[model samples]
Target: MRRRRSSGTRREGRGAPASRRQGRRRGGTDRALCGAGTRGDTPWPVDYRRSATAFLLAAALAGGAARGEGVRDPVADAVSTVSPERLAAHVARLAGFGTRHALSAGSGEGRGIDAAEAWVAARFAEIPGVEVERRRVRAFRLSGGARRVAAGWPVSSPAARFLFGLAGMGFGYREPAMSNVIARLPGREPERLILLSAHLDSRPGKRFDWRTDAPGANDDGSGVAGLLEAARALAPLPRRASVWFVAFNGEELGLLGSRQLAREIERAGLRVEAMLNLDTIGGTTTARDLPADPALPPPGTLLRVFSEGRPQHRWLDPSPRRRLAAGPSEADSPSRQLARYVRAAARRYVPDLQVELIARADRIRRGGDHFPFLRRGVAAVRFTEQREDYAHEHQDPHVENGRRYGDLPEFVDPEYMAKVTRIAVATAALLARAPRAPEEVRIDTSHLGETTTVRWRPSADPEIASYRLLARRTASPDWEIERDAGTAGEVTVALPRDDWWFAVQAVAKDGTPSLPSLAWPSDR
Candidate 1:
């Protein structure tokens, strides 16, 4: 989704203040490297619990962080292969289609929505070990007389044409058939999925004008291009979890395609570990009318990641406002955790681009394809360009008052697109290779003590070498400290439970860390 101006206050730069110093720990024993029961009993009861069978299995795997000072990282190598030229070419090709409007006509000739869908499917099919599918979306009616245009109503008069165009801008028109293009790269654990998505549809200033040329190059062509490039880079690598490269349709029409996919995921009982949606990721310039924020980093040097501040379904709570007022978990939602993960990954891999965290579901009053997955309780986040040129988005290609308008390919920065692509590649690759997050993570809040007890069920993945207990101040936006809890399923930290938020992540023997699972308060 593209917005004319940013509404919320932006939190600039990467993660918590203390996260800059890597491999550092405070107030915790490094029992993760040592065998269980090696440490003596402490003042507070500490249960260094571990399953004997799981520990024995982990010991047989390769040890240490995946990428060390001298070691070559396959993940990093794949990330380095992201090409600016290839990404730009994709944007150009998609733009050449004239219009990719969700309800646009024509197919088999590489034009309109069907052609875009076919092109995306064919590209994924070319990559070895990748399976492609076009999942059909049910036909739905468009409101505000948009069905008139869909029904081919005669508009002989200029007044009638104007009325029809106005109707197009209302909501959306009837789409008899639309499909989301999905390309799956199966891994050792096919059920555990990581998704990368972008919308494949575009619209002109006259939202209902299907015949007009709305290239949509930077708005989302760049995103689809990035999805393809990430797939190409990660396809040849060995992954622990599966990755799905999806090009969603009807995003401009209220996220219809994503909503369908989310329903399918729930119906099939598929677990989406993480979902990254790229939208308008190629623009490097601010909108013509809106001045750039002086406090923000230069356009091409930064990117924004938007995630929900609280659970998407929090409205389901009977007393949501009261519950939120009493809780300190506003910044600790699953989607927020995923956003932090992306920022951390960018810091480690995409040094050239600074990822700014927008602690909101999306731009004010605007939505994207990620919202549907987020509503389904998936850890989803969006990646968009630091600044969007509104004149280009939803505008037709024309010169008006000496200004060039429309989302044209020439306005997209290839270098910037490459950097954004790298962030996705690095994050997805690392996550795909890491062990699944520890399950049933909980913090014991029964006793009134200064120290906190964190526990979780050991990950069944044989690659898990240890677990890291992460904690941050209640007021902090990101994790501030990490303690190596080893293979032990539980740890006692010398910190006040009421003053901090805690999470646990399983670390692979090769040093890859899985997504952190927040510790829920429990009386047990």
Candidate 2:
């Protein structure tokens, strides 16, 4: 999620220098993370539910999980919070690393990218029950050009197909070399996994230039800081799904690290429930060119969700006003669902800043490591700021129009970074400490034109406090709170209509819920 030079005071200097820092769960998450009755309208794309095609009809028609009545709003408790100041300090430290470009010695011990990788590995080791590994891959070199195509996603139906072709520019360098910084927090159910990630690589070329520091302060520095902040905040809790915190490498060269890891996971039969990718997330005050949806708080908020797949709700002002859309290809990915839950949680806890769920990634033609997960059929989504600052990205250090510009730390707002860290912290703590997601969610369509009855089994976490049923119109972006019945084993309800799709989540008393369970139907 790097930006190119635009006159916009954008997240300008990336692939530059700087420091980095900072900072979630379910019913256990529902109780601890979100307040009751505060769920808002989701900005759904035109065909968001298509991804659930077979899964949808089955869940809705079945006498279980997907077909439920009365939206349940589970109660949540405050898990933990990380200080913005502490998170900001981490971002600053990352800036000091000079260039963390892909193929620049990020692993195998010391100096350059390798030194930074060591630091990341060391930090991960500090977390209890954590295991670390190094993943390798072949990648290409960075684009040797200015910041024009710095920041940028998809299709299916007529709408989806068109956008998909447009965003599918096949960027990323050809096979060169890359590595991924991987870690694991193994939980009881290995089948359900939630991942937290950030790229350890930057854009600018291998050679480091002093003038154009490319400190990457705001670019990925904010992302790394946020991940660290999250780890710090959630370290004390027990989790339902095994959590993975990865500082991905080779993203600057086109998702090399993620691609490498996804294939390995798939090969190893590692079942990943969902993935949350942290890209650029430092800009707040800087105005961004987002979809302009009213449901979203301002861009300055600690969060912004990039939902691909489905048309991500209606677009902002104007006729032919931007109508959001995404394809099951890579755009409407598993991460989209994950992002929605995160937004729902933010609405209840961190109400101070805004967190918009922008329909697409970058402006129109870019993507991040999350795409790899999507390709592998593993749920995944990307997180980043809503603005673009080109002057500082992938460019030589110089000045124009009497404005001294470079990817320097001065351009980034540290306070803004702190907020981003807090959000990451909250999400990780909740996810890590909460119970595993429910399985076999089914909708009760058998009682033709009758009440909705949904049901499912509890996760391995055993201490699940309640189960949540989320029902939304096929076109809505956000999920409405359906039913939050405590886990007394009564998993059935009545829905208003069969037109909408339903999903289930298991929450612990703290607020973290299992990876969401789409209402899966049984055979006729």
Candidate 3:
């Protein structure tokens, strides 16, 4: 079903005091991980009364959880292999190619970069029934003189066309021969699509030194591996949305391959249901000289979920004032639906997973392949490990402190990437195969002058028990459900809307929630 929620939120940054750190204590007076004191023999965060409320909510969310006294994790066979490992191998192989500069292929007949492209194309063909498509794109090989226009992208938007027209001025024979090789999977429902992609190109140089072998295994090999692993797992499960796995080249050269794909989609009037651009999923933060975020005194504390778009901050800002403006939103796009689904699914599968949504475009200065799709109003998000060891990215392959440098396989961890992939696979499969997007989502504004009434239809899944309604303002990124002591989907939030984009979703008997309703009607 089509799921589009509204986005509204407060944007002013606050001088949040340093968060107090505390260890979780059982039945004690110590504070929980949230760092607040608890009465002796009571739960860390709440006393007996509040604890009972939490337990009831848990039982409501999952009958199994209630009965078993724990969350149920789906049984997944060991995903023994992760994408970053494979990426390291591929990068190592490319390192053997000497140098894959843009224009260097023109000099050597050994088919330097073409050989690399063919190798990637061959891997995709290995996937059963997956077709490999090679697109020969022509752009000016910008060099010293003879600055004349050759063949350019056909029927591109003015902004895109201008970008492309000017982009070539920075290329030439010094660059390696470049093109894009793409592969796709037809999902159960074609209306929605999930894309998994990685850049296949690396920087140019003579010797395959630290300056040459991006070995991009960790940088993007992890991404490709994620895409492939997701496909491998989901092929057996019927999905309502189509999934596309791509190995894009020219990412180092300013996201060239992604640009072409975005323009092509726009030209064809394509519907990109959602994009999970898997870039640099490997390599945890262990670089000896790692520059730290001064604001963050201690590093490597949280697993980050870099989310953007209109509804990016929906959970944090759910109020009537921001109803039309925010909450669990990708804002009137398929991506919003995907985000809501993912957020809900994550809560379902990983109860204690710590995910922080960065309100604006992925981090301060970094960007991912999702950018192109987003520019065209397609829903998109980037999945990267929370902390990055910047030393490994885009650097020429080299060694320091007797430690092998470059995006090597040893640096990438499979288990971490597997967790990331599993959530994605589950979310994609559910969205693609669910009966349809939920029906008739309306925030009950009838009592907006006082109480909050947010509701939606439940999924027909037979196992569904009740529905959960989470509220937040447009200004915050946290979904603070006032837990008065009840089930996950107790219904009808009672929080007063001060400056929020109030939204809600129906929960099925199985404990799954429908995508959030658009913002509630404001009192104006």
Candidate 4:
């Protein structure tokens, strides 16, 4: 869905040179490019010839299409290793657990959530360079009112009964302990993290039926399997930033595990560069009864990425007044930028799969593990199948009226799941290997002019060889143009600031581009 455009009152700066204004306001460190002159209060012309050369050089170094015929991309090689058979096997084993409900009983030997957690942990442990951590999270407790409602589920109306049953699948009165299984592949720079996550819990269509077989092979079994497969494929690669494969619990219980984990990361001051949450990413078709839309891609080839465009928490901007004065940035949230990055990476690496960027947080009121991370101001996005088959999700295995129902392994398309896993692998590997994104990115808004100027602090990574400026029209979904900023921290372009959106990315010496940071308006 498209968001309505918003307009803000324009502000004009006092009569002063752009460079002097920029330098005086933000200290002399701010760089301003003009038509001619030096580093002081003079206008410096943009070296178009040099910028074009750098762009092509960066692309070649990144192993992009510009590279020579024989160049080998370790990232592409890693993605090529995604095995459909391995993905299928992982899904089958997770589905074999019957039900991985957070409050389910069997904690002793080989059943319920505990067994599922142990199995996932063991798989990650088997990876040579990966270290597994079983993090204990707080228990999820159902509210008294929800408990009462679940207990009094009506038996009269079949439709009402089915709806209530589906709602109660993840609800329970007992306070069962939960844990998140984290697998870490430490990078050369361990402080920065790129996370790939999926929930490990499942549920049936019946209310509070933890004992019944929920075999969520497609609901989240597909996602968890994708995470495992990606981790296994990436284990042998050397990275510049850490990559984490997390299997969260209590997701069906209102995102309990992710919420706790997000809080823990915040308390510990962890810097998560980006989070790619894979959830329900295996479906290949819509329900039989639903009318088909010609616009959608034929089943298994399409994937939808949902990201929040507007900040959902107060911490992002404590002052409502300040936010209002800044005009509408509904389309520039960090998560949205990350979503665009995912689409670009997928387009470059997994050409067969179509990545559709959904300009919303999730499907209506429903959410996934990414929500908690987004609320905490982390860049996060969710991967879901293009069309969900309701008949196969949250339903138990049954043959009724000649129709089979259940989230069974047979319903999941392994080839499709592998494509999604490959996308995750490529995006994560590229982000981890690239230099950190430029910081304190800002666009000049002190004066109204036909041309726009952008500035950013240089990346601390000594390997950063150059920077790239990306821009697109306000109505566009993806970046349409790029310019090499060379080694400078600022650049001015002829495009009007009001009509264009801008972002900056740091390029490593190897030509890998970091996740782009959206530039916010700054009076200075």
Candidate 5:
């Protein structure tokens, strides 16, 4: 299902002469590259070379190449640690709760929402380097004419308290507040954050049926399991940016937990480098659980990553909305770039699991935890199963016309779930360790010609040792060509400015590449 594309515009500066280096160019090497002038000369954007350790590792892997950009493979090592048995165990335990509805007993004791929350929190706590905590948040009752908003109080707010006091007297009531479980692994850089999130609450039937059995083994129990697996696999991994594994509550109630979390991150002024959401990633087939598409590989081979090319803030903020009227970057927003990064990382680390970029916020009107962060201008994306089995989602445990009809452990494929979890781990680890993408990147189109010169300001991160230039035809799904433009902020590609899209990425000293920043022409 595809949606219409919306576009917006932003401005950037033109290039000025500065330091340059002789590096690989697209099509072929050009010693007189347009960007390169002299070596060791400092440009406004500080340039550095690959670290000794990175050079050693790249040489060890690439037969003495000074900087083999493709030599970063710690992600593959981390991906291998995701255990299918452990992942299955998480789903099995979550299903044991019978139901995890937001309104279910949250006393933090046994077999319900509280129990499920405690189970997830306990799993994160067991990881050696993780700091686990639970955050209290309000859950609303939207039945009747109740207003949809986050009350946030354990009991209701003062106004909500009064409303609850008058509940039987004739006003709509709200559910008791619930808590979201958070596990953090602080990194060397505390200000930078990469989050892996999933919701724990479940709903039976079309509406909230607290007493009924809604195992949610596939709906999001699979997602929560994936989060736990990733946390366990990544807990000991060294990250430059902090990594958070969050299990949210009240998702079925309208993404309440995530909404509050995003607000808090914004209020705290933390820079979220990227957020990866695992929502529904267990189903291996379509709505009826039949065979998957024959053209595609077997189960666990394909996953859907949904993202928006346009920043949600553009629609919310008046200034950008009024001034930028170009075209919606339907396939090139920060979140979309993060989506592309996930695909690239998965291809390199978890090669067996293919990522299918959905190129939309979510499926139709459906949404996930990523939306809240996206609204705050954070790059975020959602991971879901290639095809969802409707019979195993939001349905009560029962047999209708001789077919099973509830989200159950029987429907989830443990190995498939583990592969999905590994994808999240790989992407998160790569993003957390890499430097930030270049800023204010622009393409020069002062004259229409066969070649295009792209320029950008270097990342604030001093660890960035070099930059990579990427180009693809206007209609291509992936970047088809890559050039190692060593420490140069600008590069001239042989491709015509009008024939292809171009972008630049920063390469950290460790050889990890940041998500590429699309190079848009200034006049556009």
Candidate 6:
């Protein structure tokens, strides 16, 4: 299930931010380690309630009552519609394909990669208003150690066709057409895309085997099921930004599908606010009933979100690291902030589910479709079951010691899958409905003082009703203080200037918040 290499090799950048050990607060107000190397209580400040109230009052007085004070439950309503039975059914159907190996026959009736692709497309088309399309590209075979393209890649090069033809005849290398299934639900801001994705191909014994039962029920069938369910639920909801539900092929063959898709996205120059990859999110039961990690929540209760640390102000010149030698909070990358948002959504919508934020890019030595987009500088994260059942993933069906083995539907907990699906629905709906984050934010450090002043350019989005000032201690894992700025472009707060770091967020009238735009050191 892991094939892609980290973008660290492709892009020349500063060293990674220093690693910080995450700690859990057992008593008192749970403290969060903020991106700025500070620590503090939750983001609820003393004046937050009053400030929020004041903001609401101002909106009403300004004839914004229609947008404010209106209770909306589109996300909640969509979450409620997630069906466990449907998830299980989808998993079963995908497994029924026998195998989805990347190199499997493209033309077949009910038994190969083409059949699986068609099935997903047909399912999405059943939903009204979904514009479905297939993004097909030549799959590339990577060399050992994932250092270079061994064959069938760089097909756009002028000499690629001639070279590939020779390689096919002389070295028996074949370039297969890998397709990604994309379904879009148009919104008011159609250009800004929020992608929810999963991989479609499966491996039986090894990656190249095409004639074995590779029932990837949990490996990724569970993920694809979640995507389909989210699309069905969010299709009827109100959206401010478009949502693209995607299932990529050939992930087991080194993220080929996602690699091509990410390149296409950059080529088209679309603004992808975020990409969420759902992979191996099926069972809650651990393999051999082993003890769960002491740091993780109990099984059936935790979903792990993996995000890599990157520059907070992605558009910064000379890069974020050059501006701040310490670099952005390794824990507060844009994707990490989005992970925090998802965690918050679970608390509000799926109280029974707990989302564990894994501060690293991905599991050790393992990779997923999210890698391609992450490398491209897009905020991307991967969602997986907290406690993986090793025997149930990437294993061929067999009976060992009288116990069944393989990633089969029987091992999947549909109810758990549904809960995971609800989290995705909540996140997708919330992010799409909220205004985009402020385009620019900065902190004034011209003269060191006991106070800090923050300023930001508000989003042109009419959905933005106000702005919230966020401050976090350097040691806190999350933002600890939030105050409503009431649509102000600048706010001065008295806190020991060097002790706290800050950010600003655009807030919708409904209280939905966009990902925070970190305040960078300003030249002004």
Question: How well does candidate 3 score on lDDT at residue 131?
Answer: 59
TM-score of each: 0.81, 0.67, 0.64, 0.81, 0.82, 0.82
- How does each model score on lDDT? 0.74, 0.54, 0.50, 0.74, 0.71, 0.72
Tens digits of per-residue lDDT, candidate 2, 1-524, equal 32211110001111101121000001122221122233222223333223222222222223223335332222222223556676567766776766666544533333356667767778777766678776655433322331122211101145543343344354322233345777877776666677888888665523332122446666677777777666655655555567788888767655657767877788887777667787877773434543577765565654567755443224312122112112212222345666766665554445565677765643465677776665444555677765656665564456889855445566666666665555555565556555666765554334354444454554555566567666666566655444565563233433444556667777655444555666644323
Cα miss at 467, model 6 (Å)? 0.5
- Predicted structure 1, TM vs. truth: 0.81
lDDT of 1 by residue, 210-299 (tens): 678889998799999999999999998889899999999878866778877887887998889999999999965543346756775655
Q: Mind sharing the TM-score for model 5?
A: 0.82
lDDT of 3: 0.50
lDDT of 4 by residue, 52-103 (tens): 2234334434554345545677778899999999999999999888788776
Mark the regions of model 4 whose C-alpha exceeds 4 Å error after superposition: 1-69, 107-109, 140-177, 285-290, 311-328
Q: Write the per-residue lDDT of candidate 3 for residues 30-87, one digit (tens) a residue.
A: 2121112224312233232232124223433363465574654221221222244454
Q: Which of the two candidates, 2 or 6, achieves a greater lDDT against the reference? A: 6
- By lDDT, the better pick of 3 and 4 is 4
Residue 382 in candidate 2, Cα distance off native in Å: 1.4
| Ten-residue stretch with the least lDDT total in model 1 | 4-13
Where does candidate 1 stray beyond 4 Å? 1-69, 140-177, 285-290, 311-328
How would you encode candidate 6's per-residue C-alpha lDDT over 1-524 as one tens digit per residue? 43433332111222111131012111212223222222343233433223322322332223333546354455677899999999999999999998887666554678888889889999999999899998786655432323123532435553665565455455434456568899999999888999999999888766566667788888899999999999999999878899999998888877778888888888998878888899999964554386646775556877899987753333323343332322255766667777777776776678787778887778877788887777656678899987787777778899999777788888889999999999899888878877888755766555566656666765667767778777766766666566666664666666665677787878786666777777766653
Model 1 CA lDDT for position 14: 24
List candidate 2 segments past 4 Å from native: 1-81, 106-111, 126-130, 138-178, 205-213, 284-299, 310-333, 361-363, 455-461, 473-476, 484-494, 509-511, 520-523
**For each predicted model, how many residue pairs clash, with residues at least 3 apart or on different chains?**
4, 129, 54, 1, 4, 17
